[model samples]
Target: MRRIKTRVFVIWSLIVVAAFSLVGCGSEKQTPPAAQQAQQVELNISAAVSLKDALAEIQKNYQAKNPNVKILYNLGASGALQQQIEQGAPADIFISAAPKQMNELEAKNLINKATRKNLVENKLVIVVPQDTKLNITKYEDLSQDAVQKIALGETATVPAGQYAQQVLQKLGLWDKLKERVVFAKDVRTVLAYTETGNVEAGIVYKTDAISSNKVKVAAVAPEGSHQPIVYPVAITSGTKQQKAAEAFTEYLFSAESKAIFEKYGFTMGK
Candidate 1:
């Protein structure tokens, strides 16, 4: 009986030893996190198609500073972007080229009112392919017989398109030129139409024309022709990463960021 009890005790002690050894090995081999995990954040930003180049520049610096955050941009007309937000698209930030679209979203309670801020201001311009002698020195020139292919964003949907219509109407040329208008899905597409010679001329934001060397600004739209072109940005309600969204929005106001925007021909809203 004593021998059996000793054998049982030895077996129990061996089991305890084995368990301790396994725990020690685990402690030694267990990998601590190499570094603070990049906060896995996905920020979906909807911006005006006109901002493609400028925002692309900002994204590089923004990502470098906030390495943990991932930014995805949905670039299109402000109106379309607003519609998407209203439909509950997964957008974290909304940057509209026109105040009306931002106001529309605000009315629907889709934006974080506290985070709303004016990001930049842009001027409208008529552009043509490089070296084109359309002699388009004024908006009324759009009505000329020679100018058959006039590309503009669809006025009903795109802010740029709406602005173009307003400018033409203000100049008393809307009625005559309405039929000649070639509607594009977005201002960028309108710019492309003119740049690629698909159309002879197009109206787009001056900043957008400067962003690409493929086109040249033919005329600056008169200041009184349309409402001020203001870009307002706000964090959307669908954002899971509110802090990251707000941070990115605020980054637009930073001096470094402002300079980058200015380099692309956008005036700081402030």
Candidate 2:
């Protein structure tokens, strides 16, 4: 009877060991809960629409190196994005096409001041449809009666629009041309309007103009016509993913990111 009991105990021990081994194998095949959570992290980035192409390239390169991190972009007018953030939008990072939007956020204590940095620069330009025969050769030509239905961003919110407004005001054309303006929500919208010949002309960033085959830059807004076109990047004060946001922000200033921006016609920030 004792011998029988000993054999039964050995058999039970073997069964228990097999069960544990199977569990160990299962664990090895599955990611740990902690690791799974880490891999699911999504960073929400709000950026100006003009940055779409360059930022998309940067996002691709960044994701290649950081397979675990997902970047979700909300591209639009800087002013619209600023208002969204102010209304408690779930944005981890903010990149503005102009300092005015960033400055407002900074003043409201909505952005983490320590993480703020100027990312790039752009030039405003007059663009027209590739097939256009308009005699608009310079910024001043927009004042002519022959040019009607010009597209510009809403000066109150869009940085590109605001810059264009500044230029028009500087050139003493704002009052005369405001009546002929078709306001766009963002620079990209203006580009589309110009590209499709929906408008006689549009004001947009040089970077934006170069990205499109349908639009030709008719003239570049002279320097000092407006406040400098600068892109400012910052981590939002409300972000829970501060470390990840910081990593992405720093990456924007890296040589790789700069190269991509330059390739897209953006000038690196000083």
Candidate 3:
């Protein structure tokens, strides 16, 4: 009986010794994460403010797939963002809400033209407060005396405002309604004015109106009234992280990103 017990103890000791040897071998063979990972790249993406929610979601999904890459966003009015890039802001990529900014950058050779592609499209819209009793439901309705205050983006620095201006001009409402218009710094601000009932009506992108519950879309600008609202994206010519910037720019056209954009009320650009 003692001999049997001694034999069992000896077998367990051998098993334990073998397990330790295997662990030691694995420790020597397994490479540290630092040794296996490529150099980390940080990409600064300057994009339109209307893209905030969609891009945030895309960023989360992309970083999960690319552990070696980090993303930072500089979001604001497209025209303002373009001016910053022109002034040598540290942006690796630029996504403009309208082609005007991207076109200007390409003319100045400030962007990698070859990498420029239309990313998504938006609709210009008119919105009013949800609880308002006003009968306003169209762009022309703003000309009514009851619509005393109107919100519009500043055309010089805001693409939505530029489009809104074009639509009003084409509809011949610009001259009559210009006086009542209160131009905001950005499209989101226009939405804010409408939400608070500070303005009887506001002009903004469909995406901006969708982001809020305090206001409801009153009208969609006639299709041919303005230039097509398309967002274009490209890597900046001065980007030091070209490899990473290109990777992300390419990812923007992927199916995963298309779903995210559509979910945010933006149609993918052809």
Candidate 4:
């Protein structure tokens, strides 16, 4: 009878232990309501390639302050980003290198127009490989024989290329150099071409040219040679995280962000 009592006690103890273990497992699998509510949010930002360095630094700082927020960047030419957003890409914020791309989105009601603001400006520059001995010191020198291939972004989709086209056209070099122009997908590509010595010269944003150690600025396009180079930021109309996106957009204009941009050779937008 004592043995029988001992066996029953052991079974009850095992059942209690199993019950406690099940409760612990259930608790471990569930997140607190407050924690679930404060879940991490990812904001998708599509920005011009020229804004890459500045934006990346800004993102790091912003995330440090807002620990629950994560920023994902899709950097490319402004026009290409615009097209992606138009095609229903999951972009929370859009920062374009040119007003033209932003304007197109605004016209289509794809972005919150009220949220649109000019963020920065950049200058078009001619860059050459650091070790280049090419005599192309100025934009006009591209017409010289030694400078066979000049790299510029594809004008149709690249804002830098469009600006380069305007400068070249204004200087009466567009038609003459068009045949030798090595069109790139983006300004970074143009920078790469120049950096690798694949092209005698390339046109890119002053910020991009300065970012690379392998390239050096040969000339800057005179002001007014092209349309004003403005970087504009806005929240997309389709963004579900409007509040977070707006916060990010405002953070971009903050002193900290502006200083970072300036450090990268970008000027404050007018």
- Which is the leading candidate under TM-score? 2
| TM-score preference between candidates 3 and 4, better one | 4
lDDT of 4: 0.92
Model 1: which ten-residue window has the lowest total lDDT? Answer: 31-40
lDDT of all predictions, in order shown?
0.87, 0.93, 0.92, 0.92
State every prediction's TM-score relative to the real structure.
Answer: 0.88, 0.94, 0.86, 0.89
Clash totals for all models, in order?
0, 0, 0, 0
- Tell me which residue pairs clash in candidate 1: none
lDDT of 1 by residue, 33-151 (tens): 55645467888999998889888989999999988888899998888888888888889999998889888888888998888988899899999999787788878777779898899
Candidate order by lDDT, decreasing, is: 2, 3, 4, 1
lDDT (10s digit) by residue, model 4, range 1-270: 999999999999999999999999999788566876766799999999988888888988998999889999999999999999999999999999999999999999999999988899888899998888877667898998988999989999999999999999999999999999999998899999998999999999999988999989998898789998999889999999988988888889889988999999998987
How far off is residue 96 in model 3, in Å?
0.3
Q: How far is candidate 4 from the true structure (C-alpha RMSD, Å)?
A: 3.2
On residues 161-219, what C-alpha lDDT tens digit does candidate 2 reach at each position? 99999999999999998999999999999998888889999999999999999989899
lDDT string for model 3 (21-76, tens) is 99999987886667556668889999999999999999999999998889999999
Candidate 1 C-alpha error for residue 88, in Å: 1.1
Error of 3 at 97 (Å): 0.6
